[model samples]
Target: MSQSTESTTESNPFTRPGFIVAAAMVVALVAVGIVIFLLPKGQSSAEPAPASSSTVTASPSASSDGGKSICGLPGSAETTLGTAPQSKWELVGRIATPTDPKTFGPGESDSSGFRTCFAHSPTGALYAAMNIVALGSSGSTDLEQKLADKLLVPGAGRDAAMRQAAADSRTTGSSTPIQVRGFLIKSYTPGEANIDLAFETDKGALGRTTLSMRWMDGDWKVKPADDGTTYMGATQIRDLSGLILWSGV
Candidate 1:
């Protein structure tokens, strides 16, 4: 399972036209890099099935906001709070359309300024939380740890898995922020949401997978099952100007 900041080069030799640069990167790094596998299709075993491509489209505009000029807050009566992740992770701003075409959202392009406590909608809130979890930090007070505590389901095993992934030493790359392309919300309720997110690493490693989130403590928290293939383990990137290549989901 791979999770981290998003990226995919434009003029990269490994990239091809009409293809997602990030997706191409994932294909290229499948051997040495991490993998973001799809949800098991009712298979009780933790072993991942296989990687397959999915079709994703950009978000469409909606009058749901009713002229309320704020970030794409979902239809909910909640307040969002701004937070800095231990000052270790950098915010490249929020993006629109998520890169993938299968996800749904309000048609907008600016994917920046995510809040911790209030995201208005499940998609926005969960996306922000996922970004926080995917990012890696080396500071004494790791921001990822804080987010894991707040966003993930409370458990020793969960915490340990998250910590282990964040501290992985196999990755030798840049520390640049991730770039989210698109997301698919499988199911969303007032209390819980299931999401499939697609992201690319600065090194051109692309990943997409599903996550389970539940509203707790007045906020959305990722409650990944004790499966080892939840998301890609966190790692550091050495460069951001790398190639962006993608074939399919």
Candidate 2:
């Protein structure tokens, strides 16, 4: 059997050192089979326009047509969430580790994190309560525009994905987090806030992963965590919670 362990900082939430719990979720999983996967922000009904190397914000620039100013973009002084009103990203796809980060490209990486339904705290941090779902090594994402539609936690897309992952995790009358922590950053709009986070599982740990997001339309959205992965898009369901896993719920 593969040996691993993940420890979440149960001390002070603010001072606690974020964990990655990626040992088995990443390294050991490679010994078997599987790999990593993948954005965020914007609160508008994207009219399906041209997007290829999006026009990044300048000093917290403005979105097209009197759009809001986003804080999650690539260049912004002291970022904050819900800052952008226009910004789009896509999830080309996912790849296995023991592979090349370059070949995988970038967008967002789900490492030691809880359910996607979990919301980022107003303070721009993930809540400790999320440690419960931080199991396995899998990731997901959606375009920045989609975030505008469903920026709150437990949105339909996130909830659905979490339930699917939790249920699919079943094996031998039990579940085990696949052990995956995506680590990579690339580009962004500008002035978007970031969530420096990470988590732990029974089999692994993630050191710290900074989650970037911007406020658009009226809610917060996830930005590219880095050349990690692109936004996969949204689904139709909603609900809570977060990272660090054990044997059962």
Candidate 3:
């Protein structure tokens, strides 16, 4: 009876071949779960990091000397103009007629006037201001005639008028480039304008003058002040204001 009991215990359902196979399958499933937990995340299952919400921007390209140019031509003088006028001019009442100097070219035009006279740029006006001194000092009739043409006035008394003004201002010697301190727009009309400008001479001489300008052929041209006197075609440079600190002229 004891031998029979031992045989029954050995042949129990828990020790059956089917039960052993089921236990092996359960062990394999647990091993697979552990391997899956230990494995590294890859492209197929991993998520990407959160992106930033802010955006990057670039700086502007307008330089301080961006709009400054001589005779509507790019030159070193434009950069040397100090505080005469920055790239942008201060318009008092109306918007300026000349927007871009590049379109004006180096004072060239097919209409009746000087190529330089057509320049509406502050640098162009500065060029004319400085060069006018030089021209007056030289007392060249050809230059005077050019001025008369630019002013759209009679050329008969233009030379004598310029000569007298040059003598009066003591600018008979060679005139140098003008270093403009600043400009003021006294008045403005659709086709005409008047301006006051303060400038420093090459020899540290300072002066102020009022200029009358007329707009024609898509540009501004300097005109004589309408005093209705003998000096109608003549303009004078007044004395300097104060100390000349800048030596760059």
Candidate 4:
């Protein structure tokens, strides 16, 4: 990438346009069991379109158990997995993310970067998976490297991701906005969870991906696939037939 392209990617990693194209590229690569955080080039440099005026603000419910957990964060009694979670949308890195403070946390944000803490429940795993996806696709290689180091499971996958981040830094691309459409908890246990997330691009393209999360150090960290990438089994969906059909839009 050229110096100008690198500067643009660093300056505004999340608000670029044509993310659907980038997502398509990812899907194609993942089909062959390879995943890389590369976005398509030559997209318009225009600012992202503003979110709708009717966007709802998040109102986290108070925990029934006096708002405390074993992790010393706000806790919720919701343990059973449900298809639809009560969530409101808020922009994170220009993507509309779902948040339910009482249930899933990002109970706290690390001053160091996009790293945030989540609850130790199934719902928390769901939130963590989504948040990581958004942050990983932010189009800033530096930010991605930091996230991989701090939020991914400690193993060869994490090491490989760090190396990939360093290589990606030399490349540059713009990021278009995408929104969380729905999710499905394939399986859940106290120690591990598999979450399937549905997404809609600004141009109405639909895509889906799965994340494997492991409970680590009192928080949920993405468990990398055998290929050493956090996102496993990504594909474009023609419809939301298998999804729970929920969205903040």
Once fitted onto the true fold, the runs of candidate 3 whose alpha carbons sit more than 4 angstroms away are 1-105, 109-114, 117-139, 153-178, 225-248
Model 2: residues with Cα > 4 Å off, grouped in runs: 1-149, 152-175, 178-191, 225-249
TM-score of each: 0.44, 0.27, 0.38, 0.68
Instruction: Encode model 3's per-residue lDDT on 1-249: one tens digit a residue.
Output: 555433422332111121011111211222223111222244242332232332212122222334332344432212222233323222211111122245323344334322354344334444343333223323233444455444433333434444433333221222222344434454554444555544443344334445555545444445543321121111122232221211122
Residue 167 displacement (Å), model 3: 14
For candidate 3, the C-alpha RMSD (Å) to the true structure equals 40.9
TM-score of 2: 0.27
Off by over 4 Å in 4: 1-71, 74-79, 101-103, 111-113, 170-174
lDDT of each: 0.38, 0.26, 0.33, 0.59
Poorest 10 consecutive residues by lDDT, candidate 1: 13-22
Best by TM-score: 4
What RMSD value applies to candidate 4?
Answer: 9.5
Clashes of each: 37, 62, 2, 1
List, residue by residue over 1-249, the lDDT tens digit for candidate 4. Answer: 355444443434332222112333343333333444332364343442332333222233444334233345543444445546666667656666767654566666555437467876666777787777767565656667777787878888777767766666432433435677777888876677888887776666556777888776777888775445676555666556555666667
Please rank every candidate by TM-score, starting with the best: 4, 1, 3, 2
Residue 98 lDDT (model 3):
23
Question: Please, what are the lDDT tens digits per residue for candidate 2 over residues 85-168?
Answer: 122222122211221112111112344222222122222122211122122222222222222224323345444433333333
| Candidate that beats the other on TM-score, 3 or 4, i.e. the better one | 4
Estimate candidate 3's alpha-carbon lDDT, on a 0 to 1 scale.
0.33
